[model samples]
Target chain A: MSAPRAEAVVIGASAGALEALSAILPALPARFPLPVMVVVHIPPDRRSLLAELFQAKCRVIVMEAEDKEPISPGTVYFAPADYHLLIEHDRTLSLSSDEPVLFSRPSIDVLFESAADAYGDALVAIVLTGANDDGAKGMRAVVEAGGRALVQTPESAFASAMPRAAIDLCPVARVMPLAAIAAYLLEV
Target chain B: MNGDPGSEKVEDIEIRLLLEAIYSQYHYDFRSYAMASIKRRLRQAREHLGFPTFSAMQESLLRDPALLPRLLGYLTVQVSEMFRDPSYFRALREKVVPHLRTYPSLKVWVAGCSTGEELYSLAILFREEGLEERTIFYATDINQDALHAAEAGIFGVDRIPLFTENHRKSGGKSSLSDYYQAAYGRVAFDKTLRRNVVFSDHSLVTDAVFGEMQLISCRNVMIYFDRALQDRALGLFRDSLARKGFLGLGAKESLRFSKHADAFADFVREERIYQRRFE
Candidate 1:
């Protein structure tokens, strides 16, 4: 059987997200074909340093997603702090200030469900090290849309609850280490 | 946010129908809002309101007039923080106010004023800057409930701390406490702060331009709109502003791609403030 292909990737994480994401974001080649959209739980009060911090390390272009901006390949888009990121059918990025889901503003499930609606089977979703189960519903959405889902193994994660929940909700998601997930991105 | 959108799924069809229903029955023209936001809110509405689907929601909405306001609550996001993005307010106080002072009397429109957080922030800023006496503030929103709340200017005391901190960061000249009295877990802003303020029921989506203004502060409200609706609202602002008047938008919003981009130039690029252009 042939390996499934994906056009874009969406990642969700909360606690321990920085270290877990650092391993994968910096490893992608400059010419990476797919765009990576990431949602990390950060306090709404502080301006995020994720884009600036990752831009210096990642070979691929890294920046905070702006509303109505078209999805561009060879870039990684981080959800701006405190706004839920969504993908439109036209592939333009949209941000929402609607009530937070699961006490999270930039919700993983919001991004994943919208991306699934936009990309369907051509999407790839990842759930990484976190303390909360924000990404579990998103994982299920991706899986139900026939998109591939990768969950960081609970034992291998810095915080296991999030990844463990993703597994419980969407068992078909590939259980892998962060290294393998980075490898999977390179395969694109 | 206006060209024909790509609506393909059964859910999309249902949503389009629901929006149409909303417009015809309630006169709320959400048909042109950004599809992604509409869809997101629809999902939330279905879950929270216990509608099995958009189809069911639409049916309930058509028959029950009482359901419209409840649904509009979900459709329009009313939650906002006072003095949000302090830098934006700081830039307004430092950069934009200098130009406004040139005019003997000023008009400032707070489009989509929501629950008055932004309106109160601006009112306090103007008052501190000594522009309050000369300024007439117009605050407008589509939601009547929100307009009433904006008019009342009372907020839970729990929100005051962050508001106070933000006010401080925005180069507040006077203490935030000077403007309001706290009691019973709530603070009622001195009504005198709103003495020059006018709160109105207005929808940028359907309403026409009203009154020429020296400045218009319509922030994050545009992020809810599609690209086309944004252009329409921008056009209205362009028409409404006096020559060389200013416009302030949300932190993430910009005029770079709007059809009315030529009507304004970046005043404080970092703060998304723009100045009306001759052309």
Candidate 2:
């Protein structure tokens, strides 16, 4: 297996992602070296409780990155309401009220593209269960940036369209079940 | 009002008529708000008004002055909370307050200050920061009822806990309860907070600049406007601000890609706080 060395992980998931995230985040050990960033599709105006909700489920500290907050390893960051969360040069977060892509701010594509730029070869991009094709382009960006791309196997995902879309767009490294992904990440 | 096939033209014409009537009768221009949001609100008003058609609603609006208030209620989204978006308030306290202290007498405008949550929040912020004595806050909105509600400064007791938490989150130096007195299922904020606040009718859409200001907090209201209207509102903010004055917008709104992007640099870009570029 050509196991690409992964230092940071970016996960893009939509409607059915919480199912996958629940399994993946809790399954990772406390000593995991990589940081995780997630973009969950939601309406722009409402408040997000993803950080608080995930904190109870996972060992890693979960937080919404304030603009310019440094992204640290072993912590997980979720996008805040209505703002696209991007990675700055210093590995900190940058937020923009820029126009929505795929009718979503905090878009999966925005996060994945920025993560690709920041972490390049050491990045691991995951496309989980989602109803739409939002993460496909960004998943390709991850692969093109010399990062590893993984998709939840469609038959195993809660929704298959998103992972299938990514598979179509790029030569995704693996289409693993959600449980296998967590274990694989730990070993690699 | 319900619309069948071939209703788009009638809707447009009716909207223009209602807007023109509002302009001539009320002198409140809502002509430029994004068509979709406005239409949605108007539709809600029609449903509430028991009118079966836009034409019927238009006739009633044209005839009854009181109906305008009901219409305004639906059009103006007054959803607000004290210390809403606590981090933005925290940023203002840390970054903008110091600059405001330099002014001997300060004027701050809370433009589109729906229901005055941001205005009262600012008042509390100013008082705690020791700038209240010299500051005059002009809290303006197009909705008369919302202005009235803001001027009254009463909030539901149920909301106090959340608001207090938000206040603390914004780094309050004192107990949030100290700012308001609980009575009869409501809490009346302290009069001292509003000693310098003047609530009045002002519309960013139709009204010209009234006075130069040291700071303007127009949050959330610009999202309803299209880019042209956003540009116009931004221009108004630019014009109303003193040299090096501050501008704050909603979390989801920005000056980036707007005509005024270069006119102001961010104080805290994440919080959408900016200071006018004087140099």
The whole-model lDDT of each prediction reads 0.91, 0.82
Where model 1 places Cα greater than 4 Å from the true spot, the runs are: A1-4, B1-7
lDDT minimum window of 10 residues, candidate 2 chain A: A88-97
| Predicted structure with the largest DockQ when compared to the true one | 1
Candidate 2 Cα errors over 4 Å, as ranges: A1-15, A18-188, B1-13
Clashes of 2: 0
Residue B101 of candidate 2: its Cα lDDT? 89
TM, every model: 0.96, 0.64
- Please state the error at residue A81 of candidate 1 in Å: 1.2
Q: What tens digits encode model 2's per-residue C-alpha lDDT throughout B1-279?
A: 225756345666787788778878877678776554465467768888899877888788778988888888888856778898899999999988988989999999999877778898998899899999998899999888898888889989998988988899998888888888998999998877888888888878877885789999998787666556778899999989999999998875667647878889988887899998887
Report how closely model 1 matches the true complex, as a DockQ value.
Answer: 0.71
For model 1, residues A85-145, the per-residue Cα lDDT tens digits are 9998888898888888999989999999999988998999999999989989988988998
